[model samples]
Structures are given as C-alpha cells and as structure tokens.
Target: MHWSDRYVGQDYVADEADCAVLACSVAREVLGLDIQLPGERRPGPFGRGALIQQHQADFARRVDEPADAQPVLLIARGRAQHIGVMCRLVGEWWVLHADEGAGSVLRQRLREMARQGYQVEGYYQWL
Candidate 1:
C-alpha cells in the first residue's frame, strides 16, 4: 500500500498531525512497526529545537541505500503546501505523499516541490 493512500482525505485538524506525522504514521504501518508518537526530546537541525528535522535525518539514515527501497514522500505546509515522492535517478517514481486536504494522494513532481523549499524532514519505508 502506498503511503499516499493511507491518510488521504483524513482530517488532521485538532490533531496537530502535521505532514511529518502523516508520513511517519504511514511508514510505520507499512513497515509493520508499532505506531507511536515519535519522540520529541531530541535536538533539531537548527538550534531552535525542531524534532521533525531530527526524525527525518534518522529515518533517512536508516534507509539511505537499501537496494530495494521505495521512494519516500516529501510534504510541506504553509504558502506552498504540497506532497511529492523521491525517486532513483532513473526509476519508477514512488507515491511518497499527497496533500490530504486535497482529498487525493496524487503523484506529484518532486523537482517542483523541492524548488519551492518544502522541508522533506522524514520518510516512510517498509521494514
């Protein structure tokens, strides 16, 4: 199952489940890992303490070079809210994520999203 499908159309309002949580939850379920709120007691990329950035680095490092790894999602919010997948230099694009509020886990172009500076702070992958 694609991560995009898991939470498309799901309401995140009042949940504070940002794009990072959405992608992480989908990855956990797919990887058969127990779902729990990711720990926030870690240092962030910037000195301001951003847990999401740390999670992304951790997740990315875990699967940095798996031969059979699938593409991961990159989600962003605010003025340029969107979702996209990471792909091999020449391989099928994985359905990494989608704008759930858009009610569709549609495949998106990664380059465009990256150009907009959406922080790809984490990833979902099968265990």
Candidate 2:
C-alpha cells in the first residue's frame, strides 16, 4: 500500500493535520525524509519564513519536474503558505493535501489548485 493512504481522509487540524504537519509526516513516513518547519516547537504557524527558507536551502533540492511522493508548495495570496504531496492518480499528477475549509485531506489536480488562488510554486525532494 502507498504510504499516503494513512492520511487520505484525515480531518484537517491546525498544527496537527494541517498542510505542513501532514506534508512533513508524509516526507518522513513515505520517503524516509525528515524536516523541521516553523511553529512546530512554539506557538506559531508552520513555514513562517526564515525557517522553511533555510530548511529548503540546507536540505531540499528543487526540481523542474515533480515526481511521486514529492512535496509540492501552493502559493496563497502572495506568499507560499500551503503544502501537499504529489501523487500519481488516474495517470495524472494530483496533490494530496489537507484543507481546512474542506476540514479534511483533499486530493486535487495540479491545475485546479492554481485556479483556486493557490499557485504551484514547485516541488521538492528533502535530503
């Protein structure tokens, strides 16, 4: 079974089942990759700014083409705020992410997210 199955229908919870939390969990469980993002230890949101930027610089490598199990970032408003895992489904690329509005894990097309004001910034493989 794919590692992501465990998170497919999980209800979204800030600082728990939210994007960063789930994405980070997916990374470690599915890809054996470990990452520490903002707000994990203290009271704040995940991937605030400096922490994720530095984490990306130190441990992640950006890729032109996304692949299965890669972490994909979705830009909200002007800054990138949401994250999801790239999953191959129905022969196309889909993002499995946690959505607060949906109140659960959401699987959406790569293009659909862009239309929803969440642009696909890029995908990353954590090392």
- Tens digits of per-residue lDDT, candidate 1, 3-95, equal 355455555432255444554565466445544545553322232134444344444443553222233534344322222344433454434
TM-score of candidate 1 on Cα atoms, chains taken together: 0.45
TM-score: which candidate is best?
A: 2
What's the true lDDT of residue 27 in model 1?
Answer: 48
Model 1 off-target regions past 4 Å?
1-3, 35-49, 53-91, 98-107, 119-127
Q: How accurate is candidate 1 locally (lDDT)?
A: 0.43
Error of 1 at 117 (Å): 3.9
lDDT of 1 at 92: 43
Off by over 4 Å in 2: 1-3, 38-51
